[model samples]
Target: MSFKINFDSENVSTGEFQLVAEGKYEASIINAEAKEWQGQFSIGFDVEIRSDVEQKHQGAKVLYNTLYLSSTNPEYAENTEKKRNSFLVACGYSGKQSLDLDEVVKNIIGKSVLVYIKHVEDKNDKERKYPRVSFVAESKVNPPQPSGPPITVGSDDLPF
Candidate 1:
């Protein structure tokens, strides 16, 4: 008649953890927001990993590094621009420069992306680690391929 939440469970069904090795994971931007930080506009993304990353990390999530692309100060313009271009390339939009920030955010919603990331330990605390997106490309999950060519297998071919 009642239920209890098991926060003490050793397994994390959907949470964040350190990825020991460099691995590719399918993720989707669940949230993206532009904020004015220090004097510039920077966009932050909340990327959720939806792949079976070694079974234990199936629903692991991570925060995408944010960079300022627009600043009130003039000194940060050139560097910001370069970072913007790199962002586009990493997001699979290389060679296109006419896209608006809002458009980029909106267009990426619900879109699955394959990201190559690495885990880095926090400087202050060596034991703590976080996942950082190193590169991103189009998701390769869909457009499924057949396991084998069409074959007719009788029950005799199966091993019980």
Candidate 2:
């Protein structure tokens, strides 16, 4: 019997910022440690990113904190050997911003980003299967600024 699966069209969008990046992120031979079969098998990849933004206002200052890697593909599962076959695929911007706070704020307003990724698997030199991929947004923020270096107050300065 033949079976078919359908993905929710409404939930998927091939639009801008849908995937921060797309293309082969990694490839490696399966069971590389196993002797005799070394370099005999491998897996290919394509990755995407989904990013969303929210506006927060602190007085006159507006901060645009973006959410990165909002989602992924090839759905990760627990207790599955297939998990090891996957690589760290992500989409986001890099490099320091030369623009000041005002320019950065203006550049980030009202932006929606999404990334789409795909995995290609092969067995015996023939394509075997393709799986649907998805990822949840995991955001990491920088720490707050610290005031000056540590100060050592002298005992003489202490008030009794």
Error of 2 at 15 (Å): 44
TM-score of 2: 0.16
Please report, as a residue range, the 10-residue window in candidate 2 with the lowest summed lDDT.
27-36
Location of the lowest summed lDDT over 10 successive residues in candidate 1: 50-59
lDDT of 1 by residue, 105-150 (tens): 7765555667677778899999988777765667766522447779
**Model 2 lDDT per residue over 47-140, tens place:** 2221112221111111111222112323523412233212221112244434333333343322222212243455565645332232211123
Question: Which structure among the candidates has the greatest lDDT?
Answer: 1
RMSD for each of the candidates: 10.1, 21.0
Provide backbone clash counts, one per model. Answer: 0, 13
- Quick one: best TM-score, which candidate? 1
Q: Give the TM-score of candidate 1.
A: 0.56
C-alpha TM-score for every candidate: 0.56, 0.16
